[model samples]
Target: MSLPVHLAPSLTGVAPGETVEVTGDEAHHAVAVRRLRVGETVVLTDGAGTSVTGPVGSTGKRVFTVRVDDVRREPRPQPELVVVQALPKGDRGELAVEVLTEVGVALVVPWAAARSVAVWKGERAERSRAKWQATAREAAKQARRSWLPEVAALARTAEVVDLVAGADLALVLHEGADDALVHVDVPSAGRIVLVVGPEGGLSEAEVAALVGAGARSVRLGDEVLRTSTAGVVAAAAVLARTPRWG
Candidate 1:
């Protein structure tokens, strides 16, 4: 695949017009790297559920013009999926963000659970959050997503509880839980949040806290999944059930 199309800040205020220039990095990539020609068409996304099909008009260092041939706005997802994932071990935490963003998660919240091995405290915390945000951006480009999933600040158990409580449906994925992921009734609130624990999993008290916060304890299957894999799985399953995606 070639470098993903990027939206210029100018495109933010309006929809795609007959002519739009993809400047800066996207222009450089198309001109100096991808070597796109004048007639070749490329997809430009505004990262807000809007996409435009346009052909290259001119290419230069900071000037890449593409005349819009057509434009389409995908119907926004009905139930916005937010994944609250506990920080994984080592670089696995970064990997989680990449995969979940590609999976079309609307939001990513880093949970600093009690069992989390990768602690993000003070300076390390800021750096880790920045890296995760970057990973989400790159993954969004790779996945050709029209909207970027947000990477929120590192959160503790209580903070995560608050975030989940804001959702229409909150699910806690745990092995000790008796309920299966399929058992939860999908709500019509247009938003669902999944809470995934760290490598060592959530403590018993933490589970209680989330449950108290109205998060239903849901299990994947019989097998346990790694911290990095569980969120992706849970998101896919929930998305599969949504009518808009189906």
Candidate 2:
């Protein structure tokens, strides 16, 4: 069975036989909640491609130490997958972020589309962004990912257009589009960006702006998906065609 993975702030220079300390909420969860005990094996990651596997050497109420047995550093996955998700109403925004992170999206941009029902302003915006970041972090650990997906700052239409313009392949999920996702050419390397509209769907002008920025308007299928799910399905479709999934 695979050992449970925990996140650390940094695992740089961690080596075999070294005693690494884990503190704060992370260690508390492992020790108190998960009942992690001395001599139990666990994996720690910095979530930036550095991981260390070790056995617990000591346990405290809110801290634990691991005796490192192995260290592994992975290169970031290439042909990166990035999703521009229009903010979904209520908790669906977190739902979208969680699934996207688990599916290996390298970056997630929370977009404020014209038709979006949700608004993130001032304190609410900071809290909402924090929620997304926390969700992605937990989901990445659950998926045993060495590289954690980044939750970018909430973006406006213009900012999203810049991302679309810079991607090697950019696709906008539109039910009215003529092209299907399966038919799009997947690049072997560099970045691929997918844009998912809000619950109310993308406005005509929004579609035009994205397309004008070089994104190909494409459809996932005949059945319409919810804002929280469309990006996950579209990302999986694109990733399947890339070498990362092969």
Candidate 3:
């Protein structure tokens, strides 16, 4: 089995044989919940590309120490995947964030689309965004990712259009679109963006705006998918064709 991974703020300059202290809620979970004990092996990451493998040296009520045995630094993956997911009703937002993180999406933007049923306002907006961020954090650890995916602040449609305009390749998943995602040429490097609309679907104006901003409307397949699942399915399909998946 793979070693359990814990997050650290920053692993800069960490070296083998050095003692690293892990505290806060992260340490509490590792100690009280995961039952991490002295001499147990674990992996610690700064969630920005640095990871250290070590054995537990000591444990306390809310903190633990690990004697680093090895340190590895990974460069950020090329052809970064960015997804703009329209707000889905209920808990499906978190589900989308979790699966997207697991599949290696570099960033997720929660979009407040015109046809979206769920609305984020005031406290609800902050709370909802926090949930997505927290979900990404846990999911990245579960996926053994050294670079954690970012859950960007909720984006307005105009902001999303700018993002689409800036990407090397941008796709909007539209059920009515004639172009198939597989046929699109994904760039070997640089940013690729995908936009998934909500259950109510994207309004005609929204589609036009994004496409006008340089995004190509494409479809995954004949079968329709849930709002929460389409982004991940499309992402996995696209990533599989890129060198990053190879």
Candidate 4:
């Protein structure tokens, strides 16, 4: 089995023969919950580009140390994918965040679309964003990714338009569109942004605004997918054509 991976603060200057400390909640989970022990090998990443592999050196109640034996710094993936995901109802938001991060999406933006049923207001807004971020963090570790995907703050339609306007290539999921996702040209550099609508689907105004901002309206196929799964499928399609997936 592959060694378990844990997130570290920063592995920027780390090298072989160094002892790196793991502390707080992360250590407690690995030690108490995962039953990590001395001499066991584990991988650690700063969730940026640096990662290391080492064996446990020591263990305390809420902390542990690892002897770094290998270090690697990965370059950022090409054609960075940023998905504008309209907030879904209930736990589906986290579900979307999870798969997006696992599939190597660079960023996930929670969009508040006009047709969205779930609303993020006041405390719930803060809490929902936290859930999405937490879900991404866990999913990155689970996928053993060298870089973690960022979950941006909740975005309004206007903000999303600005995002779309700035992308090298942008796409919006619309079942009614005549364009097929496979036919769209995927860029090999810069950002490729995709917008996944909510369960209620995108309003006509939303589609018009995004299209006006340079996003092409495209359909995956004849069968429509759930809001939670659409982003990942679209992301996978985009990645497939890029060197990142080659």
Candidate 5:
């Protein structure tokens, strides 16, 4: 079984035999909720590129210490998988973030597409974005990922276009498109960005804008997928064709 992982702000220069302190909510969760005890083993990650595994040395109300046994630093994986997901209504946004994080996406950009149902504005937007970030955090730990997938702020179509323009391979999911995602060439060392439309689907203008910015409109298959689930399926397709999944 994989040891439970807690997030730390930093794990720089940490080595075997050293003791690392975990505090704040993470510590509270480990202590109060998980009831981690001394001698019990756990894994901690900086959520950047470093992780450590060790037995718990001590525990307090809002803190715990781990006697470092091993330290592992992983290079950022490539080719990076970035998904521009249209905001789905209700709780589906968090669901999308969770699965995408587990599927090993490097970044998730929540887009406010022309046809999106859920609207983000003012304080509601802030709360929704926070939920997405929190969901990604817990899911990454559950997946035992050393690097957390970044949940970017909600993006507009114009911003999404800029992202698509810069990626080595960019794909926009469209059921009407002729190209299939499986047939796309995925590079091993560059960014692959996939755009998933809202439930109502992308507006014709949005499709024209993205395709004009060099994104290829592609389809997964004949069956349509939910906005929340399409990003992970598309991400898996890209990863399956790359060394990252091999």
Candidate 6:
């Protein structure tokens, strides 16, 4: 199959039977790089499975027009995957966010665990949060998702615990735990949260604290995983077990 065409905010809000004006970065790529021209048909997807087959109109340096030919609505993924990952040192945290978004996680929460090397406090916290959000947005666009995943502010351990407390099923991935992720059966709840600890792993006290906050301790497997990889793996497991994932 050909690469699914992407539409930006410029073409957003253009409904069926409406003409859309595309501009800026997307337009530049489409016109200059892709060389999409007038009369060419392309499959435009909003990234949420909502797609429109439209013929290119006037292609320009920074703008183009595409008349909507068809529209199809795709519902959002059920059992939304929310990953609560402890901020790892250096760029690993950012990589974690990027991969989780690509895996179709619905939300990414940066948690500051006891062993977390990266601290997102003060102005740094705001900037880091913005970066994570931007990463999610870019990943979502690449994945052609109509709905964007939410990047939450940097949260402390307590705050992270509180956030997942209300989820339909909240699980904390840890090593040496007896409960296997695949063995555990979950109900058809539409909202599940997975918590990942830092590189050094969640401290004993921290694990107790999380358990107190209503998160169940679950084991991924025998081998240990880095903070960056744990979230994605756990998310995949949860999504696979969920009904909608099938």
How many clashes (backbone N, Cα, C below 3 Å) per candidate?
1, 0, 0, 0, 0, 5
Output the TM-score of candidate 1.
Answer: 0.90
Candidate 1 lDDT at 132 equals: 95
lDDT of 1 by residue, 54-125 (tens): 778877786788787777777666788899989888888889999999888988999888998888889999
Cα-based lDDT for every prediction: 0.83, 0.95, 0.97, 0.94, 0.94, 0.81
Clashing pairs in 1: 47-146
TM-score of each: 0.90, 0.98, 0.99, 0.99, 0.99, 0.86
lDDT (C-alpha) at residue 66 in model 2 = 90
Best by lDDT: 3
Enumerate residue pairs that collide in model 6. Answer: 47-144, 47-145, 47-146, 48-145, 48-146
Candidate 3 displacement at residue 43 in angstroms: 0.1
Instruction: Please list the residue runs of candidate 3 whose C-alpha ends up more than 4 Å from where it truly belongs after superposition.
Output: none
Output the TM-score of candidate 6. Answer: 0.86
Tens-place lDDT digits, model 6, residues 1-246:
644465645344657777777788878878998888898877566554566768887898988877888776667778778899898998887899999998889889888889988888789989988888878877876776766788987778788778777878889998968898998777666778888998888899988887888878999999899989988988888778677677
Between candidates 2 and 3, the one scoring higher on lDDT is 3
Quote the lDDT for 162 in model 2. Answer: 99
Which residue pairs overlap in candidate 2's backbone?
none
The digit string of per-residue lDDT tens for model 5 on 17-46 reads: 999999999999989999999999999999
| TM match of model 5 to true structure | 0.99
Better of 1 and 4 by lDDT: 4
Clashing residue pairs for model 3: none
User: CA lDDT of 14 in candidate 5?
Assistant: 95
| Predicted candidate 3 versus true structure: per-residue lDDT over 106-192, tens digit per residue | 999999999899999999999999999999999999999999999999999999999999999999999999999999999989999
Q: What is the C-alpha RMSD of each candidate to the true structure, in Å?
A: 2.3, 0.9, 0.6, 0.7, 0.7, 2.6
The C-alpha stretches of model 2 lying farther than 4 A from their native spots are none
lDDT of 2 by residue, 13-126 (tens): 888999889899999999999999898999999999999998999999989999999999999998999999999999999999999998999999999999999999999999
